[model samples]
Target: MIHPVAVIGAGPFGLSTAAHLRARGIPVRVFGEPMVSWRDHMPEGMLLKSTPAASSIDAPQRGHNLVDYCDAAGIPRLVTDEDIIPVETFIGYGEWFQQKLVPELERVRVVSVDRKSGPGGQGGRSGGGFEIKLDSGELFTARAVVVATGLSGLAHLPVELRGAAADGPTPTGPVSHSSQHHDLSRFAGKELVVVGAGQSALETAALAAEAGAQVRVVSRGRGRVAFGAPPWEQPKLRPESPFGRAWSLWALSYYPQPYRHLPAEARHYLVRRVLGPLGAWWLRDRFEGKVGVREVARIVRAEAQDAHPVLTVQTLGGRTEELSADHVIAATGYRVGIAAMDFLGHELRTQLAVSRGTPKLGAGYRSSVPGLYFTGLPAAASYGPVMRFVCGTEFASPRLAKHLAAAHG
Candidate 1:
């Protein structure tokens, strides 16, 4: 069967896009397990930095907001817990929303997407759509494709470390990115080294410490930056208050129109400022003295020492030291470049085009390549930094749905 819209990834963005399309009476086929990456990768006892009201998946009119779900489930709406949306709870909410809203979703992996051509190199009609090949060897065609694959595909490790891993496994024992370190039980009582100073790094350090490993955090800087500090605490120029704030909180709280209206430069600036920095205040108290912190140091080289791994690190002051640990965890971050999406394949990736380091997305989130669109984090550079959060769907879904309706009609 030929579907009008095929959404890749069943995470928040994919589910949101699918639900919106279905609501508009557009036939939508969604692939990927609902909250698969979030469910599998995130650690237990972890909490989201976003508020419940701001982290919802469905539209406000639909009444499936996270607040409603928490209330029904008897989860307390405490201020202390406000910043602590459990990963499981969020995943459960996504799954619940998917089941209740977009039930036609298929749990499958999209291997590649290619444009279909017609007579005279017409390359299919405007609404002629394209074909999607699944890893299972199943083929399906759709008029449009929305990539909601989320952040799983884009991991950002240090350049030197990435290069070292490229040649083969690190000579100094096992070196892996934090995103790949899913199980901690195996490292129990082993010395573990974690790099980066962001929330992920801090959390991984805490987890490693809890696992009875000698955990040490190596970073280019030190000190804990709190997450979600009171708006008044920000610099006056970028204060949280409306009169002095660079942008209105109300405008950033939702998605779509507000983001669409933001200037490309402003959106780019926001992404660079927000996503690049590290803040670990939420877990600071729990981690102080418990997880060793090495600051102003860089991993110059990593090679195995006997069976254990040894890292030659250089500090900013030119002081060099060799540290040995059983394993190295780089909680660096994610790489947002479109090249990271392997499923897009070579031909489509070349045709999609990029702007300001992000995919050049149209108003409907469609790429230059017809029928293929991008949403979520990859679209943040165009849509605004809020696209990285769940709240983005509020605007993204409706806007994309309108485009789908227009194209399908």
Candidate 2:
């Protein structure tokens, strides 16, 4: 029971962090299924907005990137910026990465994580240690814990659509979040209304349309649905960045540590405005003419009428209209809130400080509670929007692993 570190996820962040930690001669245990979110949560036929080079999970070990996986697996490589990655390919790459770097990864879920404080308990940290309860009914102790659960419990639903059912959104209900759908073919021949203009909303609409469903997308009217330009279409003046060719994006993508120094207001604004609702360049061709996009339209009310979802929508200019659909899908995207992490025990949850429902992380993504770290979506509030993407693993994994190795020793 000399486990020094426990990683509570097996996504890109978790796998990368564990790989780095193990590389540093640190004893660690990783929990959760490999690439479960991308494989199970996101709908099939969906392509990642990130380019191939940006989608790789970084680690201390060599030959574990997406390109390496493709090369080893004898698959054709799409190395260009315009080459959009498919969800299936990404999932396969992630699994390969896990097997090569963190093969001992446990597929069980971590049910509860709580801080256990006592002297000389399991020879963890000097003062106290952490107890982790797995879904398999086994208990374990570790000196530190890293929470890299990507997008888990962070799905957001608009208030107007929440009233469609008493029990809330479901796969068979009148309203459901886009993350709940693994296949859009079920919506075929049905009248579908999708809200939001982000990649998820636009792509979900496109998939539903391709599945023979009549799809209509509703935007809040704050901005129009836009698409990222290809490398050639981008301006030549600005240098390249993982996000785009802008200096601001370049700075955000490369140096996420500086983001914490800015005023909270500025940081929050950039997070919301930088990577706003937009579609991938490849998605435009499939989405245009195939799906109906209603910008400047806001859903004011939603109700289930005769087992169907009906929405009263209003335009920015004050015009109101009602639209009825067989089902409503809220592609509103994720909202990071620490409270959504129901796996944290009450005592530990109370001790971890938070701001705006997200952990106020310090150096190395550590929460207020010592030895407890959080990354991925939960770290976005402190690390900027770059942490919202897979490329962030390059910046966070090494730093976090180094920090944990030093802290535990």
Residue pairs in steric clash, candidate 2?
none
Candidate 2 stretches with Cα past 4 Å from truth are 119-124
lDDT of 2 by residue, 183-299 (tens): 999999999999988999999999999999999998886858788786789889997888788898898999999898888888778888888898988888999899997875577
Worst 10 residues of 1 by lDDT: 239-248
State the C-alpha lDDT per candidate: 0.71, 0.87
> What are the clashing pairs of model 1?
129-143, 171-303, 171-304, 172-303, 172-304, 172-309
lDDT of 2 at 209: 96
Quick one: best lDDT, which candidate?
2
How many pairs of residues collide in each model? 6, 0
Pairing residues by index, what is the TM-score of model 2?
A: 0.97
Model 2 weakest 10-residue run by lDDT: 119-128
- Candidate 2 global lDDT: 0.87
| Model 1 Cα RMSD, 1 decimal | 3.7
